[model samples]
Target: MVSKVTTVAFQGIEAVPVDVQVHVGPGMVAFNVVGLPDKAVGESRERVRAALSASGLALPAKRVTVNLAPADLPKEGSHYDLPIALGVMAAIGAIPAEFLHGYAVLGELGLDGTLAPVAGVLPAAMGASALGKGLICPAASGSEAAWADRDMDILAPRSLIQLANHFKGTQVLSRPVAKLHGNAGPLPDLAEVKGQETARRALEIAAAGGHNLLMTGPPGSGKSMLASRLPSILPPLTPRELLEVSMIASLAGELAEGKLTDRRPFRAPHHSASMAALVGGGLKARPGEVSLA
Candidate 1:
């Protein structure tokens, strides 16, 4: 028998649909995740096995194949662990297939059946909302995903055990709430910084027009110190900007306490950093300090 559950493959902020199809066939025991899975997704096999064993379940003695459909897309990250495991559970009749539909799950499984948080939950939940689907996410991240579509149905289960309990009707998973801040932090005051009259003028212009300023001064110049103080005079992050920055930070796994960023980012990488790291479109195509800020 075959069981299917919906998940997502992330490319930047875009979430491509992934259909987790678990097929069990009579043969020598085998388990695998197919369809362009990256190192992280592929490693989920061992994690799922350990989690299932810890949860008092075992892979059936048969060829169990997990196919992440739309095979051409590149699948990355351990978020696929939950859907793959749930698919197998449904296929093995451990969980009812009826409860499997309409929910998109994203999480990483620990050896002891713990539900570890994974990146990209916010974007995945956004995609799930667009598709009129509910989200099943880790406890740590449900608040983060809750920022995308606050009213969307979401299940934030703390662990595999809890999730199983919820599925079996022993408990209920509650919807996560967005923790995005609507105000900026109490920034450092600007009155304490004494001198540099001309430099302060340039600083004001940079803040006003959002222009670039190259300060050429001696070693004792307050370049670093002055830059650190800009957050004080900067405007508060609106709700929209907070979500954008938070989404980026979320994908980078840098969100703290599920708190959204309220202050404008001020990233000043070392001047000696490599070009590939500074520019976003380099070989790695990663967001450099400019984009991160």
Candidate 2:
């Protein structure tokens, strides 16, 4: 029989759906994973094998083949590990196939069967929610995913055993609460500057009207110091803007502790930055300073 599990593939900050198809049949004792998977994704078989064994499940001796469908989109990252393993479990009847049908799963698995946090959980959660599906992810990322939608279903399991137990009705998993990063302290006051009336006036005008101010001065002219205080005077991001910022940060893997902040993003690249570094696009097509800001 064949079993399928839904997951996602990240393209920039967007999450694209990917279907994992697992088949177990009577034949030679072999296991294989197919699809246009990158090196990290290709190695999931070993991680899945070790993780399942640690979870007290042994692989049946049969011809087992897994295919990440669409077969054209390049699959990357270790997040495919959990879905592939779950697909195998469902195919082998270790876990009920019904439970996985409504959820999209993404996470990495350790040799000990513990789930490891992976990047792009926030975006993945958003995508899953858009599709009207639930999400299964690492516990560490549950709080991050919770921010995607309050009413969205999320399963943040700590290990393969925990997930299996929850599906088996032996244990129940609770939804994670969303978290925010508290401000460290009050920002620097503009009043601290003793002089430079013209510069101060320009800074104030720029802040009020949402304009950029170019400061040209000699050494020790306090250009950097003046720029640092801009955030204090600027307005905070709106809810929609906040989500957009957080999504970019999520894809860049820069969201600290998975906490979203209200402060507006302020990015200042060095003078020597390349064209690609200024705008978004490079070898990996990653977001740059302009896009982040």
Candidate 3:
């Protein structure tokens, strides 16, 4: 027979739906990931096996194939890591099918079977919310998932041991709260730059109205250093900005500890970035600096 669960394959900021289908049948010892997985997804077989073994479960000496659909759409990201692992968990009867039925899950697994954070929890939460499903994420990503829903059913399990326990009625998993405070500190008043007084006045005008400024000069003119201090004067990301940044991090699969980055983005792209890299149009259209920033 077969078992199925849902996760996502991200193309830029857009998340394409994917179904993780697991089939367990008697045969030789072979594990395959199908439907156009990239190098990362192909490598998940070893990680999945090692993770389960650490959790004290072994794959039966049977042929197992994981089909990520739709086959025409290429699958990407380590965010598929946990859902693939749990799909096998369900197929092998290690966890109740019902427990997984309502959630769309994703996370990378450690060889020792701990759950490591994966990117894209924010966008995944958005997709899950749209579908009215909850999400299961790595414990480190719990706080990042606070944007899903106030009563968001996002469960952040610190480890497989806890996950298994939660599934078997031996433990409970709590919801993660979204709380990040802002701070204001005294600044070196614009009156401080003695060498470039004209430039300092321009800086004040730019800072006062939240207007963008252009600084054209030769090397060693302090252009770079002046740009670096912009954050010292700007505001923090709003909850919505945090969600967008978190989603970019999620799609890139880089959300850490679910703590939204407090700084607004300021980017200077390299002239060498390829069209695909610049436009989020790789074979999978990964997030370009425009999307990430």
Instruction: Flag the better candidate by TM-score, 1 or 3.
Output: 1
Q: What value does the lDDT take at residue 10 in candidate 1?
A: 71
Of 1 and 2, the candidate ranking higher by lDDT? 2
Task: Report RMSD for candidate 2.
Answer: 1.8
Query: Tens digits of per-residue lDDT for model 3 on 196-230?
Result: 76776677678779787999999789776676666
Per-residue lDDT of 20-120 in model 1, one digit per residue for the tens? 99999998898988998888889899999999999999988899999999998878788999999899999999999878798888899989988888887
Clashing pairs in 3: 119-253, 119-254, 120-250, 144-258
Model 2 Cα lDDT, one tens digit per residue, 116-196: 888889999999999999999999888889999999999999999999999999999999888888878988778888898
For model 2, state the Cα shift of residue 180 in Å.
Answer: 0.3
**Model 2 regions lying over 4 Å from their true place:** 272-277, 280-283
TM-score of each: 0.91, 0.93, 0.85
lDDT of each: 0.83, 0.91, 0.79
The RMSD of every model to the true structure, in order and in angstroms, is 2.4, 1.8, 3.1
The list of candidate 3 runs beyond 4 A from truth reads 179-191, 195-197, 207-210, 250-255, 268-292
> Once superposed on the true structure, which residue ranges of model 1 sit more than 4 Å away at CA?
180-186, 280-286
Report backbone clashes per prediction: 0, 0, 4
Clashing pairs in 1: none
Model 2, position 71: C-alpha lDDT score: 95
Model 3 lDDT-worst window of ten: 181-190
Model 2 lDDT, full chain set: 0.91
